[model samples]
Target: MVDILEKLTIVVKRGKADKNSPYPPDLKGQDGADELTAEALKMGFTPDEVLQKALVKGMHLIGEDFSAGRAFVPEMLMAAKAMKAAMKHIEPFFKSGSVKQKGTVIMGTVQGDLHDIGKNLVAMMIEGAGWKVVDLGSDTSFEKFLAALEEYPDAIVGMSALLTTTMVNMKGITEKIKEVSPKTIVMVGGAPLSQDFCTQIGADFYSPDPQGATEYLDALVKSA
Candidate 1:
């Protein structure tokens, strides 16, 4: 069981999705995250074990490598693809309430931004890290965010903006959210954002990369 879990970790980190997935040449023809996850379940490992031990661990490794410059965006994308393949098998447990998630994350690109690349990537990274992600899509409004918050009171909010002009909107959105739910955690990021900008906007956290964001959230989950 441990060995299968390790293999699942490697396949996910290498971005192998299945026996036919050909993205990572080094892993061609090897059983991928998709297959390994099913095998693990067949081998009697629980869904939570497969999630926390293999899928999350694999993404964490690639994320840390990305943060340290040992990996890059392409690698992260492939890793995410692999994780998604595995998630096809594990998702049912979440719907069944048999596997616990770290927490819910409400993700979106701020209103008027029309940019979703960075936002989508962070959503995938956070989902790979064993959390439930509710994507609000690009050009999201404050009312929609608030509605989602009302539905998921304990969720963390992540906002993205690609334009300098649009980035300014985060300040107002963050203020409104904090005013409504003082305990809600707000995360802001985008190419134009900085730690100082994040502080000025009154957002609770900021990370330049998806991995950094996931790490911070994981720490928060552990502490909680």
Candidate 2:
């Protein structure tokens, strides 16, 4: 049983979606995350157990690899794909409220910024780390963010801006959110963003990569 779980973790970390996936040449024709996750469920492993023990464990390792330059975008995307495939089976448990998430997180690309790769990656990584993510999508406005916050008042807000021009707009959005909900935690990041800029804009956190973002949020949730 432990071996099966370990296999599932490896499949997820290496981006193996299923037996037919050939991207990772070394693991050809072997059962991947999809099959392993399903098999785990069949063997009486609870969905939450599979998620916490296998998926999250795998994702955390993959995330660290990405942060350290040991992995690239293609590898990370593959891992993301594998994670998504497994998540399809686990989502029902979440809906049933049996898999309680740490907290809700509202995330989006800032207004005038249509770029979404980084934003999406952060959202996916956060969700895989056991938080319920409410993705507001690209080119999101302050009003839309406010609406989401109103719906999930306890949610931490994350904003991304890949362009330097759009990065300037983050301050306005941050101010608007703070005006209404001073207690709301705001995190900012993107290619053009820096820790100094994050502090200047009153954003509580800034991450250079998805793993950092996930780690920051995890710490916050665990402390709460």
Candidate 3:
């Protein structure tokens, strides 16, 4: 049902969680991402189809809107909520190996950066893009990151820093990861980050927004 799939996308993009969610006045009380995703599954739609076609498609639109400044944190947060609600029904498939993820992505905020909004956004976007995201939360240290890498050898590392002071710690963390696992790719982001700074810190990529990070990871997975 192309029509149902399209509605799922709209529900996600509009941040509808379920019939009870009232944030978006226009579609209040309408069946949101939760019900629609479950309905799609009941209709025999494959999990991969729901993820790639419905979820990722909707996230891409939100990402583009964020990149163009058409959407702010509130909008993106709502989108992430919708994505999570949809994911609740499909995560079991991933765990059961019925739906394999593109890759694992280990993410966290660097030490001294207690903020989690940026890190959470990146993690949500990455997960919505079909990666198995291992979120380490805020104020994470190098040892913790290295431990996560050891657990998921093929995972790419994403580090976030909201404060300029804490951004320097990203360099130390990257170096440690490279020293232990030279092949690991480290991506850095947050308000104060720049591409040149990312290079200086020996990180592989730097994205100002979640959409950019998603695109970078998608390209990397495709190439790999």
Give the least accurate 10-residue stretch of model 1, judged by summed lDDT: 21-30
Q: Give lDDT: candidate 1, residue 90.
A: 95
lDDT (Cα, tens digit) per residue for candidate 1, span 76-130:
8899999999999999998999998999999999998999988988998999999
In candidate 3, which residue ranges exceed 4 Å CA deviation?
none
Q: Please give each candidate's TM-score.
A: 0.96, 0.97, 0.98
Q: Which regions of candidate 2 fall more than 4 Å away from where they truly are?
A: none
Taken over the whole model, the C-alpha lDDT of each candidate is 0.93, 0.91, 0.91
Superposed on all Cα atoms, the candidates' RMSDs to the truth, in angstroms, are 1.2, 1.0, 0.8
RMSD score of candidate 1 (Å): 1.2
Per-residue alpha-carbon lDDT of candidate 3 for residues 76-169, written as tens digits (9 for 90 to 100):
8898899999999999998899998989999999999999998898898888888989999999999999899989999999999989999999
**Over the stretch 2-25, how does candidate 2's per-residue lDDT look in tens digits?**
778889889988999988999699
The candidate maximizing TM-score is 3
Count: clashes, candidate 3: 0
